[model samples]
Target: MKAADDSYVRVAVLVMLSLSLLAGICATLIHWLGPVHRPMDLIVPPVGSAIFGGLIVALWRRPWWLQGIVRLALVTAVLALVAPAWFYTLQAVSTPGVQLIVVLPPVSSLFVVLLVMVMIFIPGRLAFVLALLCWLLIALPVLAYLLLHPREAWTPRGIDLLMAYGPVSLIVVVLLPVQRGMAGTIRRLASERARMEVMLHRDPLTGIHNRRLGERVLRGVFDGARSAGVIMLDVDRFKAINDTHGHPIGDRVLQAVAERCKALLRADECISRWGGEEFLVIVPDIDAAGLHLVAERLQMAIARLPVAPVRQVTASFGATMIDGADSFDSVLQRVDRALYAAKEQGGNRVVLMPVRPAAAGALASG
Candidate 1:
């Protein structure tokens, strides 16, 4: 489950447990204050209190058992509230001089609280179904009893209770499904946003960060005032491979080359498909020696494999340490020049841009 869903469960469990404690306390006060001796009423409060308290403790200690705990709490809360309302409605009807309208209306109001609780704690489809069942179990029985007793219908109180209990319950039942639909829409939108982010940043063919994301990372390295390096590599005679084999096999060659480079690089280093048949590698906290070593390793890894149908593959590399004063275009221009120099030297070799540390430092401070 997601962290948000886990948090929702925790909060729901806490709310139910707190309400159970409140109910238990109120029942205890009523039992002491009232003149009537109701043994069942007295028994319910402590039992409910124990169940809720134990559940709270169990959840606090072992939150991994949340699914089971939520299911248990939902069922327990429904039974605890529904049973009392049913028994209270029956008791109010049997006794003399008890106004059925006044008694049943208050008992029926409890369903409203139950409906809201289920909507908040449970997920959409299940919550609506549970709320509907509770309404049927509690509201239907009370409405039936009032309808059967003819004397109860003669009074204005009976009509008031009937309206509040019957039609009101039906209204909430209709609205809950609409709420569920809205929640489902929100979840789908969140999923779409995540998918769009991946598409924007990642290469579809190689499944690595693309040029746009690589440039953004490069800008961060420049801003941090740290020593870093960029290695620009182009597959030597790449067009020849595409000409010899089809584009499909050429694509496989690119994928194979990308996998080889990725396996050799450290966690902190990044390789991006710079453009057609060209790749750019970014390495942070590196000196000139380390940068050249990485470029050589990449060259060896790609040349080692057949890459199917193609007997051998080689890459020409151009590397330079990032200067503090360089902008994005300036850096690319310098690396491209070095790459041209390597290709001019007959390909499959590493060329490093000449460095002037003193001049670079002066420019950086200015």
Candidate 2:
């Protein structure tokens, strides 16, 4: 998340620098072509344009110096804006009548832009403090001058500038924190919802999908009319193991078996803790041979692993392929019966059940 935020900041910096460079160029062009031209416009615009262009090149060459460059750019922008506003206001105060052609309108709007940048680039309370200082530095002088000269304050231009630097700027500064708070809330809620969803579908002990999720997946496969392999795995003599080594050891054994089985399966396959001492494995797009192979692999995996206190831990697996005619209950029953057959034949074996004729017909028809 921090890296993502840094990336966003870097992109923002590049865009702002490009825009500043463009604005400078346009301002210089306007001064050169317009009827009313000040010497300061030619000097300041060209110098500012050159500085922004240099900053852009520096940023492109040394991207890692983003933080320092951003700070410098912001400081320069604030000075560029505030200095003009102050000069124009001071000039107006000294003159006999209202200087209707002052730079207050654009400068006031740019202060708002600066405040927005401050909010985005700076973190925590510091951003708010910086915005307040920026507002005071620029707005105070203009506001004081307007109040003292009521005639100028009453004019349309005066009112527009007054609103821009007064209520408009203050509103932006005040509401930004509220907007940030709302965004933070949305992110936190989304994170929490994802966590809750994981908790709902995952078994706490083995950290595998719970029966609920397994059932949902099975239902989806059946509804989609897709062929799949279902394997029911039962830990051999789980009760005896619990009785001999206590439940904790039994739990560890279960966890180890789950891990081993999961490692053996493909990404498309799912293994879930169906209930106590039993797990359900779902392998999509598999035939009887493939299904039997998967079951054997799981059986071998469980038989080979030794869970500490016990020299060996084993499980019996009953495997079957889905048939078109098979209902959820029918499939589960067949897999359960196959698992029982494996256990009866003496646990730690794989038993594969073939599709029944009626189910085969249903499958063919489907």
Candidate 3:
């Protein structure tokens, strides 16, 4: 797991680095053009944005430090980009003879505003604010110099380009990552919901469907679906095992019994721990006669299951088919009575529910 996680982190970082490099190229071109020229390098924004998007997906499951490292690397990339541009501007200042290329009047800072909006949505508040503060701290001296001296640095054309592109750079930084964060958060929430559903429906100890789920599945099967049967199983002498060998071993025995039952069941069947030492089995594709064969096989399967030193770790099974006269409750009551009959007749036997007619049908027919 760690190796896979590390690989994902490396891939995410690589993607982010590649995007940053592309952004650097676009920034260089933007600076290369000056005086009210438009940003023809529109392709760079999306490439950079996608790289950041990939990084967010990769880092979503990574350790906190890896996420921080990615962010820090982006900040460094920004500095590397802006620093060289300053040098380029300085050279332009000394050479009065050089003619400057011009683009749409600088709207860099305006771009940063849009980025901030994105950041607020994606990276969450803490990360977005921390990043903004870091950028502000780094730019404090430069911002102060620009404010205190407002005197233009370098060629008239160069300063105008900075005025236009600076905000765009900031906006791009904030917006790109923020959008990715929003997507990651949504994905995370969906995953959590799926996991919660699984937990609610399954038994943690036995790794089988729980009682609540078993009933729901059985109802669906009987309501409009296939012919079905209910198999109520009780581990014969299970209470004796708990009394003599202690609860811990008894718990293990229960777990063992559950696994054995699961092994015997078809994929479409469902099993649940009905209560202490008892279980409920729902077979989806069987009728009353078909279920009798299942009960015999299940009884044999229980005999085969091991319970440590105990020589006879067997279970009693009582099954019933849902006929026209029975509701779900009536079926359950009949099955319970059948199970009691098996125990009373001597343990480890399969007992089937007795058929009976409904009074309403008799009275109406009469």
Candidate 4:
């Protein structure tokens, strides 16, 4: 189900459980305080309240069990509403005086509650239909009893029942379409926003974070860390591969390189396709030795296997550890110089750059 639909169902569950609990408490109180009354009046409310309260607790603690709990609620609600109406209709037939016919049965309130529950939990046209059917089933038997015995309709109880059942049911039914429309709109908007975000921050070809997202992540890493590692890598002889084969094969090689590097890095590390054939990596809370180990692992992982269609491929890596004093531009310049040195002498090697004052820093090959 869509998130909006699931949210509506949860809201419905909470509302039904809460109202059922309150109704149960009131019914139990009425039985205990009021006259002896009907046998069911005493029995049903306390049991119903206890069950509702238990279900609420289960839902709060284990939301994963929602499907089972909702099924139980539906069955319980049907019985709670239908059983009472059936019992009261039988009582009206045999009993005497205003007790059965006065003030429209309390069952009407229960009917409305059931209708609200179905409307919110079940979505679309089906929910509305179920609400209407439930109302008919619960109300039909009592309506028939009043019709068969004309004297019963003349009483105040019959008029109150008509008033509660007529206008209230109509209003609740009307609201279903409105709720469905609003939920659908919200789901559509959420989906679109997610699609736009992916397009904006993700690389079209490699399915890894693009340069834009990498920069944003780098800023976050820089803010939080005292020392961090920044590695710049370039595929050796990348242009020759493109010329020898084709751009499609070249693209596949890039994707393979990304997959290999991603597998070897920790979760907190940020890796992105810095540009065509060049990638940037940021590892926070890492020292010079840790950064060198990471760079060596990446160098071996890429050079060990010939990514299909290219008989052999190797990458040159330049890594440096940054402290509180370094600026982003300064770090990039240092790593770039290391990358240039690696490519100049040999391709399959790792170079470590020392970070010191601009004049003091020196490059060392690893």
Instruction: Name the lDDT of candidate 4.
Output: 0.80
Q: Hey, what RMSD does candidate 3 come out at?
A: 10.1
Q: Encode model 4's per-residue lDDT on 1-366: one tens digit a residue.
A: 467666766767877788888988987897789765667777778888888899999998987788788878876887777777778777767677534465233778777777777876676778877877787777777777777877766677776666556777778778766876786798789889998997899888888889999889877766774578899999999999999999988998999999999999989898998999999999888788889989999998998756777999899998887767777788888889888878877878888878863555545454
Cα deviation at 366, candidate 4, in Å, is 5.7
lDDT of each residue in 1-366, candidate 1, tens digit only: 379877886877777777866776676677657676566567666777777788888888988887787778767767766676677667776786765455432334556666766776677578778877887776776678788876786577677667766777677667766776787798889889888987999888877779998898888887797789998889988999999998998888888888888888898898899998889999999998888787878877777857888888888888888887788887888788778777888888888774553354211100
Model 3 lDDT tens row, 1-366: 357657775675665555555654565466556344323334334445455555555565554556565665565534443443343334434466433222222333423433343353234566566556544543433343344334443547446545544565465665667567776797689778988998998887777778889888867765675667888989888888888988888888788888988888888888998877889998776766788888888788778877776676888878877766578888898788778777887768888775453331110000
- Candidate 1 weakest ten by summed lDDT: 357-366
Name the candidate, 2 or 4, with the larger lDDT value: 2
Candidate 1 or 2, higher TM-score?
A: 1
TM-score of each: 0.72, 0.68, 0.52, 0.82
Candidate 4: give the clashing pairs.
none
Quote the lDDT for 329 in model 1: 85
**Could you give me the TM-score of model 3 versus the true structure?**
0.52
> What would the per-residue lDDT of candidate 2 be over residues 78-146, giving only the tens digit for each residue?
877777777777767776664733544355666788888898778899998988898888788888888
Q: Of models 1 and 3, which has the larger lDDT?
A: 1
Colliding pairs, model 1 = none
How much lDDT does each candidate structure score? 0.76, 0.83, 0.63, 0.80
lDDT of 1: 0.76
